[model samples]
Target: MPADQQRTDLLPADALQGKQLGLSVSESPDLDRLGLLDTHFRMTLGELARTVIIAGGSLFYGGHLQPGGITNFLIEELQRYGRRDRPLKVCLAWTVHRAMTQDQIAEQKDILGLFGEIHFLSPVGDRLDGPVNEATIDDPPAEERSRALTGLRTFMTANTDARIVIGGKRAGFQGSMPGIFEEVLFSLERKQPLYLAGGFGGAALDVIRKMRPEYAEWFPPAHDMPVPDDRFLTALERIEEIVSAVQWDGFENGLSEDENRLLSASYRPSEIAALVGKGMGRLLV
Candidate 1:
C-alpha cells in the first residue's frame, strides 16, 4: 500500500506579525536606472524571505513547497551566520487574481506547506479598483499589472525597516543573463545587488564587460558544471575573459560593501518570518 497521509489544519500562530514600513521617496537610496531595477527584484527577495520564516526552514516555502531564491539564500546566509540548526518562524503574503482558482491555491498551499506558512492576497471582490481577472504572463493590463505588484511594493517600501531583510543577486546589469533584458534593466535601476551564479554564460558575461564594466566583479571563480563538452569549456573561457577585463573590487569573490549591506539587512530571520512562514524548530512567541 502507498504510505498513508494525514492533514493538519492547525498552523503556528506567530506566522504573521511584522508590519511593513514604507520609506519616503526622499529618504530612499540614490537609485540610478539600474538601482531601480534592483529594487523590484529585492522586493521579490523580501517575499521569498517571508515565505521561509512562515515555513520554518525545515520545510520548503511559498506554498508551492519548493525552495525559492529567498529561502535558499536565507538558508545559506544563516549557515554563514553560524546557526545552521535553528528553527525559524515566518509569514507570507500571496496575491491571487480571480483568473486564478481555489484549486490552484490548494495546490500551492500543499507545496508551500512542505516548507512554511503562506498568506494569500485577494482584493475585496468588487470593492477594489482594476480588473480582478487573472492575466497571462504575456499581456497584463496596466491596472491588473499594478494590482499584482503594487501591494507588495507598497508594503515593502512603506516598511523599509521591516524585521525581515530583502536582497538578490545580479548578473552584472542584467537581472539574470539569458533572460528578459528589459526586466534586467528594471532590476538594475532598483539597486538589487548583482549575484553571480556558477553557471552564468561566458557570452552573457562578455556583454556585461562591454556595457557595464563596473559590475563585473560579482562573478565568482567559475568551475565546470555537470555537463562536460567543448562548448561549455569555450563558454567558461569567454566568461573568464570578461571577468579579466573588468577592474571591479571583489570580482573573484562577491558583491562590494554597499551592495552586501543591503543584502545583509534584508535577510534577518525575525523579519523574514513575518512575510514567510517560520521553518521547523521551536516557535518562540
Candidate 2:
C-alpha cells in the first residue's frame, strides 16, 4: 500500500455497500515466531470489523458462538455501529450446532438475533453425507464432523463477496484439510476478492509461500515447527492447482501487484482496511 493510499481520509466509506465480506481467521500456532501477540491478532480482527461496518458493509463468520468466541466478538463490534438488524451473518454447520445442547443453541440464538442472523446448515450429503436436520449427533464419526465443517465453509463462500485470511492453524482441525488452507482454496476457486494478510505469519503466510515463492524470505523460517502430515501436504498441493488456473498474481481485487505484495506482508490494520477499501471500491463498482 502506498503512503497516500493509506491515508485514512482516502478510504472509501461506501466501498462495501451491499457487499458482504467473509472472514477466514483462527488462532495461529506461530504468532510468537512472527513477533506478534494474540492481542495483535484480536486487535486486527476488531479493527477490520469496525472498518467494514464503517465502510457500509456487513460480515460473515462461520465459527462457534461461545461467550468470548470470535462470533460474539464480531457481534459486539457490530453493536458499536448502527445498521439494519443483524448486520453480521453467522453460519453454523450441523456438526457445530449440534455440539451444543438445544438449550444452549436457543440461548445463543436469542443473543445473536439482536446483532446478526444464524444460519443453520444441514450436513452435506454424498461422500461426506450428514443428516438433513439441526439435530445434534452424539459423538459423530470424526470424519463426519470434519466434513460438516468443510460444508459450512463452502456455504459461506457461496454467500460472501470477498475474503480476508490471517492467522490460522496448520493441523488438528476438524475439517478434512486444515480449515485455512481449504477455505483459501475455495475463495481462489471462486476468484473472489481474496486478501492474504500474511504479515502475522500463520497458515495464511504458508499459503502465500506457494503463490509467490520468491517472497519466501518475507516469512519466518519453519524448521522448528511441527512437520505436516501427508494429508496437509496434499491439501497444499491443491492450492497450487487452484492458483495456477486463477492467475492469482494478477491481484484480482482491484489492486496492483505491488499493493498486494505489501498487503501479504503487512500487520497494520489501517493499511489492511485501506487496501481492502480501495480495492473493493473499484473492484465492486
Candidate 3:
C-alpha cells in the first residue's frame, strides 16, 4: 500500500453519530518524545467526536502529554464541528478514593463543567471528607482499589461504543498501565471495538508485542524510547509468566460473576454507532 493510503483513519465519519467513544491514554514519563503521537491521536479523536460521544478516564484528561493539559481540548473540538441540533457529549469517569486528591477532583470537575457528564465511581461506604490537598490518600486497600477500578472500567466498556488505548511505558507498573490493561481485558471479553494505538511505547504496545507480535510492523516503538528500569522488567517478566500459564478457559474461569454479567451486557461499537446514525439516540445515558 502507498504510504498515503497506509496512513488511513481508523473510524469512518458517518460511523460515529451518537455512539460513545472511549480513549485510554498513558501518563508516560517520556512526555516530550511521545507528545507528537499523543497530539495526532487526540486530533483523530477530536475529529471522530464531531458527532459521537467521547468518553475517557479522568487521569488521562489532565495529563501533561495532552496538548493544553485539560479535557477542554476534546470539548473544544466537539463544539467546533459537531451539529447544533445534536451536540456531542463528553463522559469522564474517576474513582472517589484512588490516587487522585480532592483538589485534583475539583480541578477535573471544572474542566468537565465545559463539556458533559462526569461519573464518580465509588465504593459503598467511602465518603468525600475534609480539606483538599495535592497528596493522594491511601486509605483504601490495594485489593479494594483494584476491584473498584476494574468495576469502573467494566462499566465504561459496557457503556461505550469503542475504546482506543494509546501510549505508555512498562506493561503493568508505570502510570495508568494497570488500569489500561484491565480496560483492554474488559473490552476484549465484551468483544468491543478495541483499537490499540501504540504510536508511543507503552502497555498497549507491550500487550500487542505479547499477543500479536506479527503486527509489530504496524506499530514500531519510539526511536528514543527509554530503557525499562529493573522494577518494570520484573513486572513484565511476571506478566509473561502469567500469560504463559493461563489458557483461554482458565482465563475465563478467573473472572468473578459480576464481571461475567458486565461482559454479557456490553455492545459492539459498530452496532451502537449504527443505531445512533439511524436516530435511535445516545445509549450511554
Candidate achieving the largest TM-score: 2
Candidates ranked by lDDT, best first?
Answer: 2, 3, 1
Candidate 1 structure, TM-score to reference: 0.29
**Winner on lDDT (2 vs 3):** 2
TM-scores vs. true structure, each candidate = 0.29, 0.90, 0.54
lDDT (10s digit) by residue, model 3, range 26-112:
544434554444555455445435335432211122122123743567656645653433232322223343456666656655554
Poorest stretch of ten by lDDT in candidate 2: 125-134
Model 2, 162-245: lDDT tens digits are 898888888777778888888888888888878788888878888888887655467747677777877789988988988888
| CA RMSD of all predictions | 16.0, 3.2, 9.9
lDDT by residue for model 1 (139-202), tens: 4454554444434333332222222212221222111122122222222333322222111223
The lDDT for every candidate, in the order shown, is 0.31, 0.78, 0.45
Report how far residue 205 has shifted in candidate 2, in Å: 0.4
RMSD of 2: 3.2
RMSD of 3: 9.9
The 10-residue segment of model 1 with minimum total lDDT is: 21-30
